[model samples]
Target: MDYKYIEQLLERYWACETSLQEEQILRTFFQQQEVPEHLMAYKAIFDVQQEQAEATLGEEFDERILEMIEGDPVKAIPLRGGLRRRSFLRPLYQAAGLVALILTIGIAAQHSFDEEGQSQHTQFAQTDSLERPADEFVTVPETQEAAVTVEQDSINLTR
Candidate 1:
């Protein structure tokens, strides 16, 4: 028999241009016992397709799968009342901690400022005690006349 049609179909099949009906025809042609010697190499391919087409899952397939899945039941974790309460108050606890931290920092900064202000006040008091009155007499050196000058007048002029 002339195999020009089958050869043409095989070419179209390899090029992926065959219709489903054309492919079925090729499978049927290759399934025959007397495939030509030139086309014998492709016969095994069609035989495997026919075998796979005839294959069927057993009746117990679904039952076996369901048994395997149900064999080990997943345990559910029960939520406790204390865990729920803690989760709900988590944000409140965080806010309270933040407030306590801020208050601690504020109190520390206030104490530091108070200590610095007290030290500055003490320094100012000490300097004020050591300062001489501007009205007191200041002696001139012997290079000039021995004059007991009023220091307040010179201090006022400089100011």
Candidate 2:
């Protein structure tokens, strides 16, 4: 019949001045079957609010969710044996390989150059020795007869 109080409460609600109790009263008044024509427009809104307030999750729902969480746990990888140790030693192995390669190359180069050097040294000694005067060359004798001959030659040269 009279909607003066409802109209006043709605005005306060629109103005952001209604208390929680006043809002509850408004929601309860709208739940009636024969709502005033002008207020019928607001019934749908209050009904949805009431439905949402009454909706809730049961204990069985919570139990099922907990069981699912406990059923499939995250698995951790094992780092036993030499799996992790080998990772740290990987650089050491690489350095050792590098040193072995350098040494191999160095020794090969030295041997290759040393062969050429020996041939050059022998050629230079033969040619240069033959070009020098025989009197300037001193000879060492290994036998007694050769030593005596060398001494007699030196004595004759001194004379």
Candidate 3:
């Protein structure tokens, strides 16, 4: 085969106009040790690509990356700098929850006191229907004469 077509393809390859099939043809053409003296420049390009095609970052690379992560666990926390890094908010939330808990307990205690007061009022109403006057329950106002009776008796005894 005349290498004129191969030379044309090489020009196309350098110009980046060659398709994958054309590139593959070039690789096969360069794989032959016997090439015309003019095509020697292309051998290095194809040979480098062939060598790199077999190249790989092996398990040693994986081990190195693992070692790097284990050596500094702080760097492993991805994008932590952009996250909400405020420790203050944790304490603030705890304080707010504590305040809410205390308010709930206080409101419950207040409700209990109200219930006790209502029960006492109802008991007073039931007891009020008995022979004893509701005044005996100690909620009534004292008469002026009854109030002064003790004072007058004390004065009379003193006199």
- Assess every candidate by TM-score: 0.40, 0.40, 0.48
Q: Which parts of model 2 are misplaced by more than 4 Å?
A: 65-159
lDDT of 1 by residue, 44-116 (tens): 8889889999999997997877776665533234348776666576665555444433433343344345565
Residue 91, candidate 2: C-alpha displacement in angstroms: 28
Pairs of residues clashing in candidate 1? none
Poorest 10 consecutive residues of model 2 by lDDT? 135-144
TM-score of predicted structure 1: 0.40
lDDT of 3 at 111: 39
Off by over 4 Å in 3: 60-88, 114-159
Candidate 2: TM-score? 0.40
lDDT at position 134, candidate 1 = 24
